[model samples]
Target: MKNEIIPYILANYPDLQTTKELLIHCHKLGIKYVELGIPFSDPSADGPVIQNAATKACINFNFDNLLAILLDLKKQNINLEITIMTYANPLYIYGISNFYTNFSSANVKGLLVPDIPFEERKVLTRKNHSIKNVWMISDNLPSASLKKIVSNSNFYLYLVAYLGTTGKNIQQSDSLKSTIAQVKKIKDIPVAIGFGIKDKNDVTNILNIADGAIIGTSLIIELDKSLNSAKEFLNNIIL
Candidate 1:
């Protein structure tokens, strides 16, 4: 709820130390909220950039490592809100109650589970409303169900800007515009849009309607290319 301008982290940083460092850097850049991926063997909804991040994470990272990264943020006194983007299998393995408990204990504000459905959320919601259980509503989600999901979400709704796995794309669709207009009609909760938002111009276009923007692949690509330059660009990205 605290002005969620999420900049996604691939979570597959070259090393844990570097990941922590990058998080610290982002915090310094005045990022209000961050959604970091929990690397899994198969990141089905991810595109090439996220897939590569997951691959690297699997080879060098684990849940404990990710937990350490979060804990490190706490240690650094970074007050930015945190959300974990991951698949459901890991949560099931961790036990939904225990996973929620752990995340709440770590000061995580929310979660983004692409695979979880509204009916399934009822199961987790009972035990975990303490932490924001965020949900996604694509262009495909029915109007009734989307309203239900948004009403249920404690965190602001996450609206995917472009469909097909998270990747770079040019031009917003008429579908996306209608969806935003529809969501605006339903509720006043913060609505943050993501997937392929590349630069300041993208944010400018989205901010007129959306409460905030979530950017990832572009920043990661930039970071992968040059950290310093990426940081400079990030610093320049106004709300």
Candidate 2:
């Protein structure tokens, strides 16, 4: 799979048409891989930026809205490597088998579940080997656990730069550099860095150590501010 700089975006926008338009914006920005966040009532792993977006999305458009967006993406032949970032509760409530089956048919290529324990990964991997469920690891994770976790992951390993929730913060410090260096030595699946990546400098900075960077909170905030002009908003960053 193409492990490029995959920037995340909220899937639960106010309208599906605008969401599609934002996707076109991303494609124009030359970003091939896109992580679309699936909003739930209670997103434990998400920070305030995403939490607010989810709240708005839930009020304006709920689970049915997400399914409709998926269906629309299918019908429009949007053809992008789309990964759904969601918590386990929604999947369990929707029935894992059904979620996989539906998401597979909708052409979703991967999954990201933050709260699922490492020991229970098999619960997801075994459910459907075809679904590329990416696992999360943080800077504090032990080397042994990380090695095992990354080894077991088929898609990608999400490396959290810090322990805090996602939002604006300084770039990953020297300790993060050491951590990335250690992770680089492992050489399992592609290691993608996320959490607290705020600007273009972050893009160039993270590229030095990891295969890709996942920017979520920054993108969400920008998307919110540019609700009326997503293309212009994205161009200001990507260009």
RMSD of each: 2.2, 2.4
Q: What are the per-residue Cα lDDT tens digits for candidate 2 across 1-239?
A: 33466778777565667677777667767877778887766778778888887877766655556666667767887667778888887777777777777777666778888778788875575454366877888778888997787766677777787877777574658877776667667765677788888777887788777788888787777667776455665566566
lDDT of 1 at 200: 85
Span of 10 residues, lowest total lDDT, candidate 1? 122-131
- Candidate 1 at 31: error in angstroms? 1.2
lDDT of 2 at 64: 59
The global Cα lDDT (0 to 1) of model 2 is 0.73
Clashes of each: 0, 0
Candidate 1, superposed: residue stretches over 4 Å from native: 1-4, 126-129
Task: Write the residue-wise lDDT of candidate 1 on 108-153 in tens digits.
Answer: 8888888887778765664434677777877888999887877666
Could you tell me every candidate's TM-score relative to the true structure?
0.89, 0.87
Measured on C-alpha atoms, candidate 1 has an lDDT of 0.75
In terms of TM-score, the best-performing candidate is 1
